[model samples]
Target: MTETFQISPEQAEMYEAKYVPAIFAQWAPLLLDAAHVTTGQRVLDVACGTGILARSAADRVGPSGAVTGLDLNEGMLTVARRLAPDVEWRHGDAADLPFEPDSYDAVLCQSGLMFFPDPDQTLREMRRVCRPGGTVGVQVYASLGSQPAYGPWVELVARHAGPEATRLLSTYWAHGDLDELGRRFDTAGLVVEDVHTRLGTVRWASADEMVQVEIEGSPLIDRISDAQYTAIRNESRELLGEYRTDTGLQAPIGAHLVIARQR
Candidate 1:
């Protein structure tokens, strides 16, 4: 039996609507490029939230090739299915993939590495499903301090909402150190071909919307109080002032990209 991860429908919808466009979409191309995804090739997007990466992979591979997105969250899979019914979606644990061995030409994971209970096991599973010499790409945020606006946001949340809230937000940037991550790949028996940092910008209509999405669109939903929300907003307005633009709260965000080949 497969283990299911639960998230609210509203949160899943919010993630598809706000987080994907603002953040995840920007990194899809990077991962695809690193994996060298091309036409007529089987691709698996592990932890494919809302299926942006899988949908993008589908476009690259065309109809001849196949793309499957697997995630633990049924709610996310629901939204993903609604968005792109053509692509296959599955709900299962990342640490334990349900597919057969050597099943795909390439396997890609985006911004989902940190949250896994056992990242090394997940990478091992990703490698197991990829054919020998095929590509396996993974991306994780560089670090909380390295990311622009979010670091301060986490700090502000800590001040108001306490350590648990801060921990929830900070998890986004976990598993940042390159050496440590590379070792996990090494331990998983994946041959590291390249590793580097990629940067993208996050823009929200306002600091409030940015904060709202980061909190409400995540597990932090209902975990914070109205007074706390008010404090976070008021402080972020001044704290994140430099990132403000005509469009919204814009800031440079970065992630470490790893391209490894199955041996």
Candidate 2:
């Protein structure tokens, strides 16, 4: 059965400040490289949270090129606008793009495709707007199994959040399987050119630092009541303790870089 998903404004803002923003920063260059963005290419970033990737693309494309960022969350757009005022920021859904066909030379989506209610429809919309021969690039978490840090966070939240945790976590995690990704692209009339996997690391000064990041920066933290917050934090700390090292707490994160072209 399909799971119902919802994210509050406050939760969205928290995500922007914490892991989401940092993770995007870590992968922005690789994503841009995969998209092969040139100096004069028009680019579109769907679900451009805080404009990390959008702003990065803007820098690469230079003044000659234009970048447009679209997101459903006004809060995120506000952040993106503040960060990159020169780029266009629009409030919209990935499943239905507002621009005309053949509008963008390249389209980039970072860790946003999996949250889409209908990923196929979203990709089709991306294809429709992208100019022929333009590239469509997307990045998704490889899988929960591959990420050590996220697993603990998921476990802690699931224990305290019960059913709600499942819904929230489902929206943010995925495995990078080419077959599945290719099938989605094929349905959208786009051909998958490359699917690359990258390893990322999330480090914290200590277990407490990690727990605080999750507590203050993750949407899952706000969903639970104050009564349950301490329990969740303690459990997350315990889980993170396993990964602690002399230097810090280090956890493995992986993602799939999928690049496609309209067929």
- Best prediction by lDDT: 1
lDDT of each: 0.88, 0.81
Residue-level lDDT tens digits of model 2 in 32-67: 998899899999999897788889899999999999
lDDT (Cα, tens digit) per residue for candidate 1, span 12-66: 9998998799888989998898878999999999999899999999999999999
Q: Candidate 1, after superposition: displacement of residue 145 in Å?
A: 2.2
Among the numbered candidates, top TM-score falls to 1
Determine which window of 10 residues in candidate 1 has minimal summed lDDT: 1-10
Candidate 1 ranges with C-alpha deviation above 4 Å: 1-5, 8-10, 156-166, 215-229
lDDT of 1 at 34: 82
